[model samples]
Target: MAKIEFAWELGAHTGHVTTMLPVAAALKARGHEVRFLLREPHAAADLEGAAEIPREGAPIWSGPTINANPLNLGEILLNFGYHEAGPVKALIDAWREQLRASQAVIANVAPAAHLAARTLGIPSFEVSQGFHVPPPAMPAAPLRDWEPAPRARLEAADRRVLNSINQALAAFRGNPLTTIGDLFAGRSMLLTYPELDVYPERGPSDYYGITKSAEGKLVPDWPVGDGPRVFVYLYHYYKGLASLADALARQRCSTLALCRGVDSDIKGRHHGGSVYFAEEPMSVSRVLPQADIVICHASHQMTAQALLAGKPLLLLPTQLEQFLITRRVVRYGAGLGIAPEVNNPDYTSALTALAEGSEYASKAREFSDRYARHERGAALATMIARIEAALG
Candidate 1:
């Protein structure tokens, strides 16, 4: 049996952890030794106590960014410790130790993990939504077409990011990547639908469509009420939670909310109303069918699920990645993107707009129809098949 390691170097949230779990489990089932290396070990809630989060971790860059408004994937990596060699080396070295210790025969990795594996000449493939695997051939295509940055600005950002990567390469006695995109160029297993892709410039690939969240197994059990069925999948402590929850109750929408860490007071305030709070993670598979409109941070999995179910969306983006995904959803007219930072954001209005329109629902169905024949768990099955083939 071969020892294989799956690694995630960046990003916050259970989404990354949850998305990779099933694939890891599948490999383990096949009698291959499998392990996970996550940026945030604690996010591995309870994976049947089999999930191991290494104490020696991947470098998570939270310091001041050289490029605050990243134009593309290359620039985005710049913000996350790619602007300087010291940080990049530190990040890569951290991943090196973990990969080395695992004695990894093969690797399925997110960004930094792959870089570390490359330095050690470890063969690997990427498993993610398309954003991280930037196209080296087309280096400067903007992430959002409507919000294009100046070419000079992009080049400058790329230079810094690439220089750092090259410097780190030098330290590892590796060849330098010619362009910023080359830093992330490699074999990728994209896990999103076509329309919801973060990188429009990335064109097309063999997508491994999405699977259900590994965090929760329970199907939704919404409270009975007489209004638009809205599914809330945002974080409990999000700034807009109070207003959004209150608005859902005030609007009398039959809401099934899964605010993972929601407090008692908020639940209390909405008590006796139509809002039902799921203290645990609820299956997106179950929630999507029952939802008239999906409200979330526009994470790829939820967005894909809502679209696949032909349901409209009211997006509340909390970060760059979520915002990027939200932009794609809105661009397709499948949803509306509302930043969580908006002053007392109008959740009620967004909900009403999505609920009141057939246009958004229609756009969502276009996505659903496109992949109407997609077999459930086919992506997971295909991924395993590829790995097994490669093993042989």
Candidate 2:
């Protein structure tokens, strides 16, 4: 059996680590030796059996924290800048060592990892949980060469971010400067949202069929009740859903709110007759199957699992991309999307429709049936096989 080393360069919460760990386990089941290189303070403890290779020891370098929060625009921009300098160089240094030992490397869509893998002449694959399409073809309005200087300034700032990323990549690989679009063009393998839930109109890629395993075993004794229950996933960074637990409680629906790393000051305010606050990662698969409806941001994993459970969703998406993903759900007749800034809008009306609407429930059931027909472990098995073949 081939010895395969997999690096989960960043692991903040359970979701970020989901893509690699399942594939690693499947490889082990297939009689291959698999090692996991992870960052410290992992959120998921189940990964203990896999050899823990620290970021400092791994051949590919990674930042101390993983940036997965979609709403932190300022943090995103700052991270883009920070990665351009220190982490990118460190990764190049690490990749040089990895090339002497390993046959290939795989990374998430982080540009620094891509650059390092390229520099070492190692085949790298990009795995993710979102769509990676080119920006939609929209009509470009002519920029006034003189007026509207603010718009031009914004454009220049955007270009600088892209330039910073490109320069770092080119510096390490000794290649001419290329646009961010060019760097992503046809270089890395793309594993994104599984095709079963995503629209079929989108073009196929090398790794589009990968599906995440259900987390049912995590919470075998999930709570159930007589009344209609709603499960809400609240991220500390996204404040749009701050009042959601209370709202569900006020409606007299049984509720469980999973708060991920929220501050102590903000906890337990939503307590009422029917609502409950759960700080731990509750088994979403168990909660989702019995949920009358789900309220969340456009977290693809949670949203996808809810759909697979035949539960209609009400998405309070906080970003442009999330809004777009929610739109896909609406287009597919599976869920509803609420703009984060629109607080006065009637979320109750949407939730009411989701819980009682026959059309919405039918669509959700259809999606669940379709997803169930596929072989459950095919995607993870395929990824392990590909990595083993690459090692060979």
Candidate 3:
């Protein structure tokens, strides 16, 4: 059995853990041992039999959210190291010793993991949800297709970040990381999103479609009844949440709103016989099948899962990363994105379009069909073979 190390030390949220679970499970099932060096121990509780790397000091993003402006690698690296060489060095060293013995490594937004693997002369793989990168080398405009001026700004920012990465790599006598493209260049990338959603202009990678968690999490209690079942999984702390909850309450449907950090007062205001609010842990997979419509932040993981259920989404994105995904959903004709500055009426109108309309549902089903045909069993076998080759 080959040893595989998985490392992530970015956000406190569960996105990274959820994305990696299926791959790790696939590896373990093949008699390959998998271990984790997670920034948040709680994030990996669902990892089953995976062992933890006995090290500390995973970079933490204490920012309000994980989205980086302009979606550039330099901004992301700076956010993690704050332009400080010491922190960047520490970040790399933290993984170096812990991951040195592994035959291969799979990482999620952890540059340190990649750096460590390079220093040890082991192959490194990236498991991402599509938007963890900067602009590609190709000229295709990303997302909404930024104008020339804004695109220039983003390009300049990327150059600055690449310089920083090079400086860090040079400190350890490692090959200089020439650019954001160079960072991911020639590496085996495993993405969980469609090409339409990721850097479409980039070279081919293993696109495994949307993956589900190996197991479900704390699923909120489902409401009983045959009325249109609406599942509300949104950012509880968003300023627009109160108005959104109120809008849901006004709908002639049975709603279960599970939001984090929402005011109890807001829940009390909207609680009714048809609308219930519970901020408990929820198995999105289990609950998604029962949901007729899902309203949530346009996180890659949640958005992909919602599409798998063939449920149309009313995405309310709080950051650019989410906005990017939302744009693709709209292009796919599967969902709508509500602007953060939108009033209650606009938000409710979009929600109505998603719930009352059949067009979105039709597109959603098409995507669901495509998702089902991804052939996870084949993907797993292919991945194992790749891992074996990498080990060789």
Q: Which candidate number has the best TM-score? A: 1
lDDT of 2 by residue, 289-391 (tens): 7678887876666777777788888888765545656776887887888877785657667777877777887888888887676554676666666666666
Model 1, which residues run further than 4 Å from truth? 47-56, 59-62, 101-109, 144-148
lDDT per residue (tens digit) for residues 1-392 in model 1: 76678777667877777777777777787787777666776774653333542222445667777666667766777767777899888888877777785534233235666678779876667777776666675355677566857788777777777788888889889888777556545456778877877777667667778864565655656776777999888887788788888888878888988887688999888876799887766666766787898898888877888888999888888887798898889999998988656887777778888878889999999989988888757778887777666555
Clashing pairs in 3: 218-281, 218-282, 219-282, 219-283
Judge candidate 2 against the unseen true structure and give its global Cα lDDT, from 0 to 1: 0.56
Ranking by TM-score: 1, 3, 2
Give the per-residue Cα lDDT of candidate 2 at 265: 50
Q: What's the count of clashing pairs in each model shown? A: 0, 0, 4
Minimum summed lDDT over a 10-residue window in model 3 is located at 47-56
Q: Which 10-residue span in candidate 1 carries the lowest summed lDDT? A: 47-56
Q: Write the per-residue lDDT of candidate 3 for residues 58-156, one digit (tens) a residue.
A: 544343323344345555556676355456667677677787668888878777788768877889887776566543462223444552336665556
Instruction: Score each candidate by Cα lDDT.
Output: 0.75, 0.56, 0.68
Candidate 3: residue 258 lDDT (0-100):
69
lDDT of 2 at 337: 84
Looking at model 2, the pairs that clash are none
- TM-score on alpha carbons, each prediction: 0.90, 0.72, 0.84
